[model samples]
Target chain A: MEVAVSIITGLMILGALYAIHAKDLLSSVIACGIVGYSLVICFLLLKAPDLAIVQIVVDTITLIIMVAVVLDSSREELFLKPDTQGYVTTLTGVFLLAIFLYFFVISVQSLDILGKGSLRMAEQYINGAAQKTGSANLVTGVVFDFRGYDTMGEAVVLVTAVLGVLTILRIKGKK
Target chain B: MKGMTLIVKKTTQLMAGIVFMYGIYVIVHGHLTPGGGFAGGVIIAGSLILVTLAFGSDFLKLVKEEAGTTLIESFATLMFILIAVSGFFFGTRIFFNNFLPKGVVGHLISAGVLPLYNIFVGTEVAASIFIIFLSLIIFKEESAQ
Candidate 1:
């Protein structure tokens, strides 16, 4: 499982890099889709089927929208020659990434080993969750019951996003 | 934009129904399964997108969906809020309190209020996403003209 996770992560990085560098907008969008779909695989491998389901469908819809937009417009992105500023920006980005990676490794080492995470906070949720929520699926119980307010907030956020999109897309003055 | 071919259209006709039903199943069985409203809602939107892509969407049709989507999304959110707030009128007068009887653990009606939340949230999410897609399409059409 670890090996598969690592391999899929590698594939995701590859897809992301290609998406950033690809000249054709359509192919770039497809490469971005590859990254999202691989993330779905990662979610499933990590035993989060709920997230995987959302990721796959959301990724597909996002890909369709991106491809539609790209196809409607010009497919070819303007190619710019690598200048000194561009090289400096790339170096700064790589440096920032290395710093993040260093901290990530440190954090991983300081954490509990895999499969033995401390359930100090989740103990109650894990023990009496089935009886308290009266739901077979604990995740949904926690999401809808124990954390119902948070769920409502999430729904409100989604609604606000849609409203923002519609408002922004509306015509200026007349109808 | 036009559809691909006859074969694609025929395949979509058979498959979109299955996808739509699967999304409903996910939302209905949310308390008993790994999927819930949000995932199911996105899946439902996906089915709609598949149909729109395969058969092609019309300008007038999108306008209707746009209006209905906003209304349905608002309605679902209102229902969800009402259900949550209605808890104040029920046992313990607590917000989002489980006032309904929790059936058998594994049964469809097991969860007190989770299923209702899932159903309402499912509709809200589906309509929101569908409207976003519709708006994008309509924008494209208007821009093209």
Candidate 2:
């Protein structure tokens, strides 16, 4: 299962690379959606159902928004322009990719802090959560109590984005 | 061509309403099932997209300008934060620290503030998503036409 998951993830990463280089806007959008869908699958296989659910939902919304943005853009060189930015952008992209690949490989081999925390807390939460929070769902306990602040921050970030859009886009008299 | 599209539009409107109700069901029962804020939110957003497809851009304009989806979105966000902050006043050492009663495990009133937060998230997500699409459509139509 792990090997199959790895293969799928590799394919997804390659798809993302292709998305960057794809000449057509529609193809790029499709590739982006493929990447998001594959990531959800990858998250599921990693045994984080909550993460998987959140990823898939957020991803679908993001994909739709991005496609809409692309469609709305009037720029003729939407995807046809090759990178003309001297060596700066190319070098930056290569450096970032390499660093991300290295970290990704390292993360796969070891238990990161989050994984450790989840493993350590999973049993305790499962055993006592019902009595403490009166909730059957362990994921809910973790989200609403253990790391509720983080989730709240995420919601705030989302709201900020919405507010920014409204302020910039609202016509003068049209409330 | 335009006349043939009206039938398609009406059909999609009906479908959108059905889908929207399903999303509401998923959201309201989220605590007991696999669906929660994220899943239910997306489902609702999908339904809104259907409305766009069926009813034409005029419907979108009406919803955007008159429905106050943006205000709902903002209020939902504020309420979510306020609920989280409610924990701080209890001196529980951690925010959202199960300050209220959790109630019965499977009851509708269970999970302390979780369900409340979920509802807020669902509303924000649904409204934001609809607004996102509406803005894009408006931009495209204005620019292209």
Among these predicted structures, which one has the highest TM-score?
Answer: 1
- A101-155 per-residue lDDT for model 2 (tens digits): 9999988777654334556556776778767776666666666667787878777
The DockQ scores of all candidates, in the order shown, are 0.80, 0.47
Q: Weakest 10 consecutive residues, lDDT, candidate 2 chain B?
A: B58-67
What ranges in model 2 sit over 4 Å off?
Answer: A72-85, A88-126, A170-175, B1-4, B63-67, B85-97, B139-145
Q: What is the alpha-carbon lDDT for the whole of candidate 1?
A: 0.89
Error of 1 at B69 (Å): 1.1
Q: What are the Cα lDDT values of the candidates?
A: 0.89, 0.73
Q: Residue B26 error for model 1, in Å?
A: 0.6
Tens digit of lDDT per residue, candidate 2, span B54-139?
Answer: 66665446444425877888888889888877778875766676677778888877888788877888888888777776765555
Report the error of model 2 at residue A168, Å.
Answer: 3.1
Query: Model 1 chain B, TM?
Result: 0.95
Tell me the tens digit of each residue's lDDT in model 1 across A63-154: 88888789778999999999999999999999999999999998888788655665787887888888998999889999998899999999
lDDT of 1 at B25: 99
